[model samples]
Target: MPAARGGRWGRLPERRARQLQRQMQAKEERIAELETENAVLHLRLAQRLRLAGTAGTRWREGLPQRTRSLLRLQQAAQRLRQDLRELRAASADLLGSCRDQQQDSLSRILAAVQSAQHHGALPSWRARALRLEQSLQELSARFHRERQRRRRLHNRLVELQGNIRVHCRIRPAMPAAAEPPDPVSHSSSASGDVAHAVDDETVLVRCSRPGHHAVHKTFHFERVYGPAEGQAAVFADVCPLLTSLLDGYNVCIMAYGQTGSGKTHTMLGPRPPGAAQADTGLIPRAAEELFRLLSEDPSERPRVEVSVVEVYNNDIFDLLAEDGCAERPGLRREVLTTREGRKAVSPLTCLPVGSAGELMELVGAGLRLRARRATSVHADSSRSHLVVTVTLTAAASRDGTPEPRSSPSPPQAPSCPSPSPPATGRRPRAPRRASSGSPGAPPESPARPAGQVRARLQLVDLAGSECAAASGARGPALREASFINRSLAALADVLGALAARRDHVPYRNSKLTHLLQDALGGDAKLLVIVCVSPHRQHVAETLQSLGFGARARQVERQGGRGRPAPRGPR
Candidate 1:
């Protein structure tokens, strides 16, 4: 029994040992699975770290390069602004230095003048010094005024950089009708047959003769021909208006004609030899007359101011201002408001002239500055219209009593044989413009006193309206002809409208209209001189001029101031 019990205990122990071995195998398998999962999580975490490092490197690399590029652009802009400021400062400094030098030169000249006055024989140094002083004084004054103006303009430029009103003048062209037949080629025999067959046919006059005919001979058309009539004849029609101007009206006299029609000759006499003269044009002539009338009357104190301007390609230029004084550079048109508020433009320049000599000088200077170019028609054809304005101011007796009358007679056409008498009447006065101001102020207004008579006399030498084929103007001249034709068409339209009494006139169509707005439509007395040549070759041009004159006469009649009727037969 003891041996059997011992065997049982041994069997139980073996079974227990087998159970412990199975439990160990299962624990080992579970530990292996946890180890595999831990390895995968470690691989994923390493990959994530690598991706973050690459993104950080890319961000770091791009930041400084972009920052540097931005810095460069900022630096360039700063430099450009700095350069402009420096240039403006340098210009101002240079002007100041010039003025200083001029003053020193003038002082030395004055010293020399004083010494020369006291000495019996002037030293060469003293004589030179005197002349130098006068020159320097004049130069200094000019520089000073220019500097002030420049400063003002600079300020204005800064203010108006992009705010200014810009305008362009485009001359309208007359739509061409069917070209007329060559008058010379129509044979009389052919005409007679055609006339008989048609019955209602119109016979056209052929002015052109063959080369064999004496009338067909060609003559050189001189651009600067001597005046068509004597000064007396030219002034005959203009005398009454001139008298009114002197009587205290702002008067403007304009010469309108085709190119090569003696506009310059009519306005300005033939150029004199070996002498620089300004008192040759109608402007100077009128100025001389005004002074003469003023000098003749002791009771009247007359003050005259003048402004000269030229309109080129619809651009306004101030001839009186310093050369290259463009307030807004590259602009074609500009407005000039007088201290009184009268506005004129298209490259306009205003100046004040106290005497006939000064006025003449100003006109001469303006002529020099005018846009002139040699063409087939004229040596120095004015490419644009020239406007010279004369403003006359008169003061009557302070007592307010009726002023003494030089001539009691009212305005009347002068009788021939007796020298043309001056105009006699109280000149019509106009309200002072809102733009004119005192002499000391900027000439922002163009208005003057109303009680004081004001007149504007305009002299317009219209560009010749020529066919492109006839003028042989190519390239630039062709362009110029186009512009000229447009301007003339506009003028013709204005005349037609005035003659027809249209309620709405298109005066704002072009620069020419704006420039001539007052003369054609304003209250001031207006005179137009239409010059014609009697040459048979110029018959077409002559006919055109006569037609224009006739139209103008019609306008005058409509306006209640037509030409006086012819007197009864002698």
Candidate 2:
């Protein structure tokens, strides 16, 4: 029995030892599997997921086994439980770390993709912007080329027409509700008045008459303006004339109409601040455009001079007369003639102008000094004719000779009138007031030089034709009206003679005609802007005005037959 007990105890020790070995082997295998998974996760997730070092190299190698005498199988089972808990904790931590790293890697990859997309699109946007700029440049070039071609055609037409252009503008009629009763309206009935613009260049007038069938008359012209048009639109038609003046041709622009017409308004515009820049008149706008053209070529700084004159009561007065000028401004006959026989009336005030603002100042002063009167026909009637002359002289050539200019061409068969399209305009920019210098600055530019091609531009504002009876004139007013009528009649005679191919144009018949002799007889370009009233009361005067315009048009037709044409190359 003792022998049997000893053998059983020995076998029990062996069994326990084998059991311990089996448990150690299982723990080792589990640790190895966890380590391998951690390694793979670290590589896949890169730096984001990292596993902690094993508890110690000894634990990884193998734990020492306990003897049956020191440690029982139950104690071994408890140790195994502790090791299992520790391994599970480590594995849980590793899994949490790997999940966080994976999330971070996904975010980084998304950001990289977005950055690549943005960089790739940069060149496409830049190329589109470049194309827009190139297109704008090309359009600008094409516009300028087309404008040059148009200018050439305009010059040809102007020369072929004998440098004379006739344009008629009809004043708008006041609504019957707003218009006062016509003091001079004849033929009983005050209604049934019609004024129609038959075409762009034709105006038809019809009115009721007690003893006759409805009177009808038609007037034809080169250009016409309806009431809806504004100052800017009218100026566009005159824009090409400026280019001609710049090429060294004398230009005359005259407004003719009865009293209360819009001649003053057309020539000078409404009083300054009350009007918008786009509403300003032709003279001011011309000055602005002229300066802009000059600025284009800074190398040739040209000089500009201006003079203002008024013809009142058959007498000439220099609105800008100097301190040592003629004895009496209104009666002065002082005249100046250059060696080349270019005639200009002297004793008139002449001002050196560098900018449009300065020119306007002089003009305002002249307006104040001009003779005016209030008549029954108009609240503020112009009693005198005003002529504002602007002279431009180009810079001399480097060879001390005048630059070649386009000389006027001889009168030929009338060129087919080109129908001018109605102009579209925008708000004009306000111009900077140009002065000589600082408040008291030095000369803005050099003095006028010789050997330069000089050209003249005249803006003539004629007083409205007055009805002695309707205006209720007496005393000096009546005398003034008579003088105005006589002078206008003489002007008509001059036009008729020119149209008839007479030897003399009778330019000396009146002071107004005498002063316009050079413009009428020479190769100077002339533009007559006939202003007509649409009021029923002014029917007779309107007819007379239309007759005058027709004669002027005839003069234009024959190239001002009495006037001589230019010779030699321009």
Candidate 3:
């Protein structure tokens, strides 16, 4: 039934149905729109979700880096706090140190103030010290005076004993030869102190050999000279002996040694023009000293006369004789006995020496004469023994004292006019060195003695004792060497006898001894300069020379008494 009804209605409502279906379709389309809108909203929401997720992932990755930065800032803040704490502590320590230093400075200042407060007593102490120094000075002055007095007394004592004193002098060794193969043999031994000076009084000589034990000897003397010593040193020790001559004493100075051992050099010294006055030999210095001493007291000085002689081949020749200068040729011998048993040269040119210069001239003249014609070991060698006499006689003065005759109006001696060449000497016997007499003066008396203080100072340069074989001599030089050795032996004998205090001496042994008889035997002060070569090669001759010195020393030690010269008018 319902179906029939529905069909009937359906047929009647076709138009209406169509309209209602359209309405339905509209409703369906609306639904589809709603679904599509929803789908679109969902797609947009998914895209927003994807973007938020990516932003969250980025935040997560950056979180650790930010955390690490915060941690580093915290650590830096901690370090800053630590540094401030240390600064605070250091400030405290510096304040404490300053306090301590201030206290120390205060203490030092207090100490200085206290010292200054106690300075009132220094003046008294200083005054006391000055007084003590004054007293000490006075004592020193007194001691000096006493020493001087003692020295004077001792000099007088030594002068009174007219003994022969020996002084040894050692010359310096010259440059050695080119180094020899065996220098030990030519060299001085280690024990060369055999010539060593222990003091002013003692000398030691030590000897040693390869197979033999060392042997030594010691000698005593008044003075000794070493290689380093010079002429001034020797003269200093001898000055006292010279002073004795001024006090009215006879003095004889003799130099003896072997050939080439400084014998001539010690007496006459090196040739002039090259040497100085202070370094001249004993003879020149002695003359100069005489003039100086006389000048000190001219009113009391004695008249001086000089004569030079030479003993060649045991024959005495007057160096200032008239023979060589005036044609009275042959050598003049010494007159054996004179007025008072004295020795005098027959034709001695007793020239009056006014000054030291004149004395030097005479010496030069005598040297020239010696070199004129001579045979010698050395060209300038003194082949003959030289004897220079400086005779002093007291001249009358207003006060009865001695006076040196200064008058230049006296005559010349050994008259020679228009003298020859350099070989001949000028008139040596002039009354005075500065005398205004003729150049050709004649020989005259020795001197006019107002008082008897007759003193003869003889400077004897003995010919050296050398071996003939060593000298290479053929005739005259060999003969001269023999005579020299003989005369030296004679001298040694004389010294030995004097040392033994014998009653008689062998004065007649040789011409030299005979000529010096009076000066040797009498109470004459004698000085011997024993010159020696400091060479090992000269050991033999050195021993001989030293032995001679020893004997001479014995003579003095054994009381070789001397008589002072007569003090009154002759």
Candidate 4:
């Protein structure tokens, strides 16, 4: 069995080898089939991958171009956004400017509409009315433009007709009980009613002596006011001058009369309790009118200053001074002549005033300090000359803003000397600050800088001229009378000199005349209101005053212009 096992084992080994070979072959065929199937699967996978890649490539075709296009679109969109931002910015700017223009245009249209409504044209639907309203609106605008020119022309006309205008006023006859009996003239009538206003322009003085024939004298003046004439009537003629004042002209209105002739009444109006608005005097009335005009256009916001001075016993006193609440003899000032020949007062108290009432209060305060004394001719008489000067300063700005107040400095000379005359319709500009050390040039005032316009309104109430004997003067009264007479004589001399066209006018002869040198020299519009009592006792003074008025009428002066305001942007 062992031998058989060995042989069988060896044969089995061969058999095993052959069996292994067949098994190896079968496994190879199986491996080859598996490899083919695996190769087919690989081919299929490669095809699928190629197809997927091709489809993906086809789907992704023009990706760079599309990306570039998208980038371009984004850039274009960004540019559009930028352009839109720029357009918005531009529109904002345009709108801002247009709004400003529209605001101005709307204001003008509203004014026109209001004017149309005022004339009852707004309610009318008729074509004719509409056309008329349109024409009226146009005319109104034209009139507004021409108004300033008209003012210039009117002022020129006033200058041509004599810059100095004279008016005469007759006071009513005083009660016999009030008049002192004339001891020297016993033959004279008890009631000395002699002066009378014959008409609106004529004054007649009728005097009859016992043995002499009746003597009648008539004087012609610009206007004559009877005692019956109200203050309104007298102011009607003087009202036009206020307009000239606003046109940058210096104006002076003075009252001249004998004692007790009603000058105070006419100038200051009825005293206190008896005084009504209708009976107010020229000073208050003028103040009212001035403020009224300024109120019409508050944008201008013109500045007004007031200074009051009194000439008492040939001495000038600054009534507006700090200690000048009452008649303080120490509150004296010196009148100075500028290099430009204009009069100025140093250390003058010039207070700023806003309204007419405020200005009047100032005036009233000054008047309280004015010199007054009782005389035989009247119970209360003005013993001094009162001068109230109102200065109007108009400042302009390049940027249309209010000017800031500057530090205080010495005031400059107020005279303007232009190289050439202004155009026909244009107003002259305000005086400019002069160069240092130049002729007639003073140091510029901090309050008033360059390119500022100034105008002055001087109101004067002169003390009465009376005979010493008639006034029953003694002691100080006699001295006052003498000085008064001398000043009156000097005034007459100055007027005569002006009338005769004398090259040398004695303006320094008296303090009164010297103080009013500018007004008398024809640089200003001067209005003289001559007041007289309608009584034979005062006939001599009346005649003298009338003669003075006549002389003043003959005095012609060339009017000087103040600086014209600058025109603002329309």
lDDT of all predictions, in order shown?
A: 0.52, 0.68, 0.67, 0.75
Better of 2 and 3 by lDDT: 2
What tens digits encode model 4's per-residue C-alpha lDDT throughout 1-570? 999988888897898899999999999999999999999999999999999999889769978888999999999999999999999999999999999999999999999888878866745647777899999999967876887678768777776655799999988766667777755355334356788888989999888766556769989999999988988987887777887777767789999988887787778798662556788888898999899987876556666778888877777766655541222233566677665456876556676677898898878878776766678877777788889988876665777543432333344333322233221211122222222111112111333465566678899988899988788888767777777778888998999999999989999899989888888985688899999988776777988999999999998775464332233311
TM-score of 4: 0.65
TM values, all candidates: 0.49, 0.61, 0.62, 0.65
Once model 3 is optimally superposed onto the true structure by TM-score, how far is the C-alpha of residue 408 displaced, in angstroms?
6.9
Q: What is the lDDT of residue 332 in candidate 1?
A: 36
Stretch of 10 with least lDDT, candidate 4: 435-444
Weakest 10 consecutive residues, lDDT, candidate 1? Answer: 162-171
Could you tell me how far off, in angstroms, the CA of residue 338 lies in candidate 1 after the best superposition?
A: 8.7
The lowest-lDDT stretch of 10 consecutive residues in candidate 2 is 437-446
What are the runs in model 4 whose C-alpha is more than 4 Å off?
1-144, 183-191, 211-214, 272-274, 324-328, 399-447, 559-570
Q: Top model by lDDT, which number?
A: 4
Cα lDDT tens digits for candidate 1, 1-570:
999999999899689989998889999998899899999989998999999999899979999998999999999999999998999999999999999999999999999878877674557667888999999999977975885565445434422321111111111111123112334543332231110111111111124446633322122110112222344445544555565454333345666665665566567655531223432455556667767766775555545555666666654544554322222222233554455435565233344455677777767766665665656644556677777776644434444322332221222221112222211111111222222222211222334323333345555555566566655677766766777778777877887887788897777666777677656765445566655443333445544654565565455322212211111100
lDDT of 4: 0.75
Candidate 2 per-residue lDDT, tens place, 385-423, comes to: 888888765545666534543232232221222233211
Scanning candidate 3 in windows of ten residues, the lowest lDDT window is: 435-444
